[model samples]
Target: MSEKKPSLLEGFKAFLMRGNVIDLAVAVVIGAAFTNIVNAVVKGVINPLVGAFGTKNLDSYSSCLKAPCEVGPDGEMQGIQIMWGSVLGATLQFLITAAVVYFLMVLPMARYLARREAQRKAKEGVQETLEVTELEVLKEIRDALVAQRAGGNAGPEGSPAPGDRG
Candidate 1:
């Protein structure tokens, strides 16, 4: 009998359902939403602060390659312009987003996971110690019983051995 191959749709569904894929999708959606907030902060707070040096409107800060740039009646321009201000704004937005995600999400999650792992290891260490102690106790009891049998004093109320002291 030939083994049936999974359909393409089934494979795609499985890939989508995988934990990493789902997490990435969620992250993308969250990042997209976070981008808006970050943009607002950069535009509102940062640009104004930088405006102390120059102007608040960064988009207008550009160098026209062709001098005498044509201007319309409605305060519009037409010329080859290098918009470095917009680039600066975009760059700042990216840096802020990365920093926020690292501190707010990645750093906290890593710390929490580390703490959880430490607690689990501590519990396991305690359990291991208990197991070792139990084994040692059992061995002692067996040795005591053997000694009593050899001495022909294996009664219910036999004298306690040195190792058998409570």
Candidate 2:
């Protein structure tokens, strides 16, 4: 008998039904929306500030050859145009994103988790100390029981019986 292949719909349904897959899909959508905001911030605020430092636009800072460079048919210089400015802009955006995520999300989350851990540790410490104290008390009780048993078996003047002497 030939094996039946799973349909695309079934595969898609399984994918969507997975917990992590659905979460990832939601995260991707949110990330895309957040990217737009970050892009606007970079283009509007950061670019102007960088431009004031003589870099004009983020797309214009590149190494270009002067005279003796090969000329195209349109009389334009034909040299290796390294678009380093775009790279710089992308790098800046990444830095900004990292900074924002760190300060806004990661830092607070870390602090909250730390506080929770500390509280848990404090609770555990108290529990462990209580257990230790209880054990100590139990040991004292056991020692008392053993002492009582020994006392009951001993002779009147704290001497052993003839048969107890070893």
Predicted candidate 1 versus true structure: per-residue lDDT over 128-161, tens digit per residue = 9999999999999999878876876435567664
**Tens digit per residue, CA lDDT, model 2, 36-91:** 98999999999999999886589888765444446699988687666789999999
Q: Give me the runs in candidate 2 sitting further than 4 Å from their true place.
A: 1-11, 66-78, 152-166
Clashing pairs in 2: none
Cα distance off (Å), candidate 1, residue 162: 19
Give me the overall lDDT of model 2.
0.87
Clashes by residue pair, model 1: none
